[model samples]
Target: MNAELEARRVERESSRVISAHARSWQLVSALRVEDFDVAHLGRADQVILDMEDAIDDRLKQQARDHVLEWFAGGGKAWVRVNDVTTPFWSDDLSALAGSPGVLGVMLAKTESAEQVSVTHHRLGGHVPVIPLVESALGIEEATSIARAPGAHRLAFGSGDYRKDTGTANEAVAMAYPRTRLVLASRIGGLTGPIDGPTVGSVHSLLREQSEDAVVLGMTGKLCLDHEQPAVINEEFSPSPADVAWAVDFLEKFEAGGRVIRDGSDKPRLARAELITRRASYFHVDPR
Candidate 1:
């Protein structure tokens, strides 16, 4: 096929994957497999059994064992394996090769499209991979990573990126990287990128962060703890007011262009359509 046809085909497939994940605002609250049933699973839109940042080097083998046991018992989740440069990453991929329960792998500290490709190849191409960009270099390569062969989507690893670059933990300080990932997702025809967790237990902070993420075009948020998932899901969802406005706007805009074009936002109308579609698909009753 020509390049245009190939690009269209990829975009179509990416859209399919993104739509599947549209409602999964909260995902894989990274937790040890030992605590899987007791905590992480079923609490969020999705769960990620994190073996990378959550596990210490000494506990790597033990954590891997627990993860394997969980999968053996028919459990399912995305696993956040260590970075590609680490020895643990090779082992992590090896363990995941024939595992039945891994929905995907969230490759931490991903810095290139090549790493994303190798990850899929190493796992034998059985599952989709979401590259978790965590460093300055990773953010620089965000667009390429998003467009990579195995990348289902890109996720921001805000804390690590901040630490690596000596930037503050606040949203404003991180806006550059955040916006980069967002634009990269769009440019690469991938899903809206996943935002980093809002760290603290403050409810207001969580809402503010999730709302900020929504405004910046993220479809999902990574949850760091149990209390975060509910708040993230609700905040990421379309508000009653938004749904009502979307319903009203769609009716007016569909009637004709001349009546609504004065001082109205064309781009916002498209966003309204998405809000309405999501609300309808999720059976949300707008007031």
Candidate 2:
């Protein structure tokens, strides 16, 4: 990275951070041609017109044309194209380039910061990108990818990753990768990375995973089921009850309660502030 390019990278990274803070979206729902209309009913924070995993290889061209029609008609959404190395990638890019409907591109199986730059250049304009990092190598380079010039943020492809690493999809099995992406986003000054989905519409499991993401400092999640969005949004956000608790704790701490004024006062204050900050995302006007 030359000085000029480094400067440009910094500028774009700043844009990404600003863009993330200004956006209140929390859930990303993947959709195919069959589900396009339902997706527009607004059940999700963002819709990914999936051309990679969701569609069969034989139907790739059909999916591309359908998506192109949707774009040309002025509909807007992110398109999750195949990886850069695949044949489908160029075709997906060709269909997506310069379309007003493209909110951004979600580059599937993103492994390197350089790959993000290539996707950005090929897009022919300054479209924000969310790189879906899945492989072990991708997770290792997560910080670089998160800070890459065109990347808006990162998304963990948990299922594929589990397959790659031969690990179960259990939370403990997936913890390192999840934590890596989340910390990388924070380090890069981007909004928290989007965590992967919980399958089978299991509300209990969904809530558990979503809460885990929140505890790990992630605010957004990729949702497969439509109902998963509400769960993700709720779990990531500090509810009114949480706000109340934070306020009461702060007040008592200010009044010098021994427990509140204990050695942990500083961390308590920071926690309260973080609770309020998370609450603010949902327009939670504190009373």
Candidate 3:
């Protein structure tokens, strides 16, 4: 059984290749073991096994056991563990230490650099740890948190953030926190931050929310449902028009000896270069 589990673990690790530019991050409740299957993950670029916020206190152990079983059975995913201040955090770390199929961990309710450093250490200091900044304090400490050891990237816990600050869920109301996270990630030399999930069945609304996040420099989004990934992915990715414009601009600039005509030329060149690179990364061909 041990050898078979190891084989499965190796196979699982080898087969699942998640991109750093993955836009759709779907979170599945650890309590719902059935949802861990590939079929249920839909088009999500990545999946997170949520052990915090989704499970009740009484079922924490059961949830942990289920996640371990899934990993043992060849499931691969990032796990959203409880906050550092919680009793569940220690047990969560212990259960996940040396576990196969753990892509990384998302530390919930992270408000300080110490929490991120401790979680990273507990996870053996190699696995990526994304801190979910969810409160005023976390937002205030955003840069420090992003600079913490093992901080791969930051994610916004928008719902909890709104609740914490009595702010509305509107894009205008949420922009400050989202912008803070984006700036912090950049300053910390990390990739763009992941925006929080949208909570609704409406595809148009999801796209709009995803677009808002994208405009605020969030390259990825946490999604709540299987159907939401496609929308988030589409919205977050560079559009065909953008690719076409980038291709045209680069060709013209190269043909013109790459001369900067004015102040606007520099920013335009930067934008064009960025778009083409992102297009290539996302496998989007110029139209």
* Best lDDT among the predictions, by candidate number: 3
In terms of TM-score, the best-performing candidate is: 3
Between the candidate structures 1 and 3, which one is better when assessed by TM-score? 3
Off by over 4 Å in 1: 1-31, 257-259, 262-265
Candidate 2 ranges with C-alpha deviation above 4 Å = 1-32, 247-263, 285-287
Give per-residue lDDT, candidate 3, residue 34: 78
- How should the candidates be ordered by lDDT, best one leading? 3, 1, 2
Candidate 1 pairs with clashing backbones: 28-47, 28-48
**C-alpha-based local distance difference test score of model 2:** 0.76
lDDT of 1 by residue, 1-34 (tens): 2566446534443432232454343333244444
TM-score of each: 0.87, 0.83, 0.92
Clashing pairs in 2: none
lDDT of 3 by residue, 1-287 (tens): 36765575565545332546778899999998878875233578788999999688999999999999988876778999999999999999999999988989999999999999999999899989999999999999999999999999899999999999999989999899999999999999988999999998999889889989999999999998888988887898899999998888888888986556888988889989988877776688877
Model 1 C-alpha RMSD vs. true structure (Å) is 8.7
Worst 10 residues of 3 by lDDT: 10-19
State each model's CA lDDT, in order. 0.78, 0.76, 0.88
Model 1 lDDT, residue 31, Cα: 41
